[model samples]
Target: MAHDGSDRSGRTEIDHSRRRVLAASGIAIAGSVGVAGCLGDDAGDPFDDYGPQAAALESTAVSWDDLGDLEGELTIYSGRTRDQIDPLFEMIEDEYPDFTVEVDQDGNEDQLNSLREEGENSPADIFYTQSSGALAALKSDGLARELPEDITGAVDDDWSDPDGEWTGASGRVRAIMYDTDEFDGADLPEDIFAYAEDEQFQDVISTRPNSGTFRSFITAMIEMEGEDETRGWVSDMVNQQNATLYSSGSQQAEEVAYGDQDIGLGNQYYAGRILNEDPDATLDVAFTSDDPGCLFNVSGVAILSASDRPNLAAEFTRHILAAEGQEFFVDVNGEYPVIDGVEYVGDLPTVDEINPPSFDLNALGDVEAASDLLREEGMTV
Candidate 1:
């Protein structure tokens, strides 16, 4: 496999139509993606501009008033943890005090299951999850409603469902989050296969075996490499290298940063979010020599078909895609903003430069086989 960010890994070279699901950062992809948080109860502009770039930000971002008098309760079944998105809820409250957003956060699979089983009586106005796969699943089941035009149009066409059932709220790039003091990322092998046999990485590595994005990556492997090869590679790497498995990407990055392990196979933002809190922390994110390990997965929102509050539900999605919401997500969570013009904070690579895999994003919806394969290898799913 070539170390440069080119398509020498045997996978098909996808064109722009297929490329819609993924966007690269200028710092990471060098092509697309032109790309922060806060607290408090203020009486001034409910949705005030954020950061130093607030005034200079493009005024095209849809505003709360743009949705036309949104009101009523909005229940959310979210995969994003409370701490990761408190700022979002706070802004919503400050913007529309009459509108209610009650969130019940859980694993994406669990919440997805709830939505599937609940159907019309799900009590969920929105399903906000970490995996586009889950959103795809819901869309396939006819469980999600078509988003309003403004909400759908707020983001790039590729970042949302082709049918407009869901829209990506924020994105995380798959990368090797490493302890900078331990290894120079620039010299790290570009091929993901290197980690399994390369003596330099051996037992010093950590990963999230059950992550939604991890399964998506496995699904891509199944599409790119045969199932047998992906299975063999995973089993060999886990057993041969004595790899340590963590529950979440954040934990994996934390363990590596503290020297519990030297390297972590996880999303790029986990390290950035951690670094913001502890500047002295010896953690930072690095990409694969190219795109092998860099899969771009998104956390997004969808309106539930059963929702009686379509106006409010659409308005919430609208708020999320606009500038105020985009800033809060990027600044606080360190994830990529899906829309252009929003400020991108942190030292992470631009979305275009990360070199995400070319597998069609829409195809990632069904990954039960991949999840089962990971579990069958005696790995946690």
Candidate 2:
């Protein structure tokens, strides 16, 4: 929890022309597509046929006890910090008086490695991480069990695993938070891509992708815009001498509030968490032009492949993904719901209204590709 809120010197921007020019060239040839512009067969219900494989896993009648029963205190290694996960624990206790859910907030890499080495014997039964890289890794290693059929059918098609391994429980958008006092809203860059060249924003932007959250954001960019284009954007970010990088998203938000930097390219939750902790923190979200660059990051929940409590785990998983579970997700956590109906608070734009770029969840399951992209951008974190 060290609060080193200043920009790190000796940090250099990457070369931008190669990727950006190529992407712009391609888009120029293909023509502009509407933000909510539909794709082939993407027209139907979001999760029309999700979880077909998971549906074949088990056919037991879902029960409250089945979902709630924990022979022992169930352990959770979550990406959420103590305050964020605390409300979830309280909700479980109230709903299922029969069992207890114990949680520990561990770093993303630690939890990923634990699940990898320990496999089915791992002490962690459920792992919630901010990025999909670990999920892709677990799936690649065959460490993830197919999600429950019921859970699959409930979430958006874009949110769940087609192969039934892991599903996105909640999502966060990659948005910019700026201090309006220092920069006028009308004068703000219209697209994040402009930050690299916009003279008005020079040395005023900061971000952190070393963490899993930022990793996914970049990966989504590569998928939507292609490798060269994404690489170009990162390079431009460096060339413009834009973006003071940090180790985490919350750190970036603090820099904006203190005026060390005016804008931060990070998740919306980091700003929300800061507000929850400090009511007077000055910050507001900036929406660049809706494109794949405005990536929608998934924070997913997956049952281990070797769980002795599959039934109990499935029950809990269903509860979290269900309508009731979805409501608590937004009401308490401020995350976007994966399920159909849930109310969201805050002044942030709605998912549809924001028209954030869409990325295939299946593609998100590719960790090697994600890792490679990060390295290509000269990102060590």
Candidate 3:
């Protein structure tokens, strides 16, 4: 869908003025209201009525009430599938009759290429994608605009651009998906590198070289351990260890649960998805301590430099950072919320508890180098 060139003149002066004041004062309007106050009596208590999942939405910093009447047209070039992020836009559309969004969902690479090709004429107000590497790539290409301080301040600095180009909307940690029937979490190596060097893990662990998550992991490895070491690790896993390669993280999790493999390199949420489908699944997730295997990658959103409706785009981006938006990610996608105050819903430890090694997330932009190394090592097709 394309923007119809409609203006924001329909919004009330008070709504526009309120947002401006909040932005100027560096106040987070998204997190200012309570859930009950935002929902009102007719909507009732979401936490009490909607059960545990709804509880994640409670005490959120941002509410629909704070956003005011978000009336405008926005075109979002999303790397996440429609089922993953469209519902949030659906909620926004339902809440504000005047607001409408057009989502062009495609692969992250394709979307990034299109944004680059379109240049300043691109209709995309927002670029929502699955990896920080892609967001950084856009920023490096000068396709992204600096977000407002209020929006940037909502999330932790680690998950956002140091230059204020993009902000992480949700997070996932690299974890070892192991078969509960075969081994306990304690039995696994604490360091991810051990799987490549240790004989015990040989021919038992699975990985997805073609997966975006894996590429991002490799990118982090190259940044932290240097390219030579990172390339060697990939080579050892593929050649010496006889590591099995899967098509996707979910497949890796499923294979491990089925006992086809003792362990697999995947994301924490893949296991959460498995349990959600069948609580009795023989799968469990384990994390590596202070290693690249424990890399915390995020699916983030950015405002494009070519966007004409930056204010509306900022509001929508803020909506994703708000309490309800964060809750949707945790409750639906089994991902962690990037903002503070929103409680993590799953069995895994919170982001702070995971405490992934502090690396420059923006450095992940050079994913091409990681991919080249993977190909040179015969890791991908």
Candidate 1 TM-score versus the reference: 0.81
Ranking by TM-score: 3, 1, 2
* lDDT for each residue of candidate 2 in 1-381, tens digit (9 for 90 to 100): 111123223222223243234334442111221123211122221222321112121121122222323323456767765555556555555655556676656777777877788876786667777676667767878887776566766667677777878888787787778886787666666566677667766777777867776767666677777888777778767666555778856667888876578888888777766665566777777666666546776778887766655555555676566444555555555578775534465556678767676567556655556667667666554
User: Distance from true position, residue 376, model 2, in Å?
Assistant: 6.2
lDDT of 2: 0.62
In model 1, the number of clashes is: 14
Query: Against the unseen true structure, what C-alpha lDDT does each candidate score?
Result: 0.69, 0.62, 0.75
| Best first by lDDT, ranked | 3, 1, 2
* Per-residue C-alpha lDDT of model 3 across residues 1-381, encoded as one tens digit per residue: 222234223321112343344344544343443322122123222311221112121223455456534666779998876556766777677766767788788889889999999999997889998889889999999999887776777777888998889999999999888888887888888887888999988889888887676788998898888999998899999899998988867677888888579888888888887786688988888789887999988999998888766666776676787766776777667799887656676766677777578877898886889889999998884
Best by lDDT: 3
Residue 373, candidate 1: C-alpha displacement in angstroms: 1.1
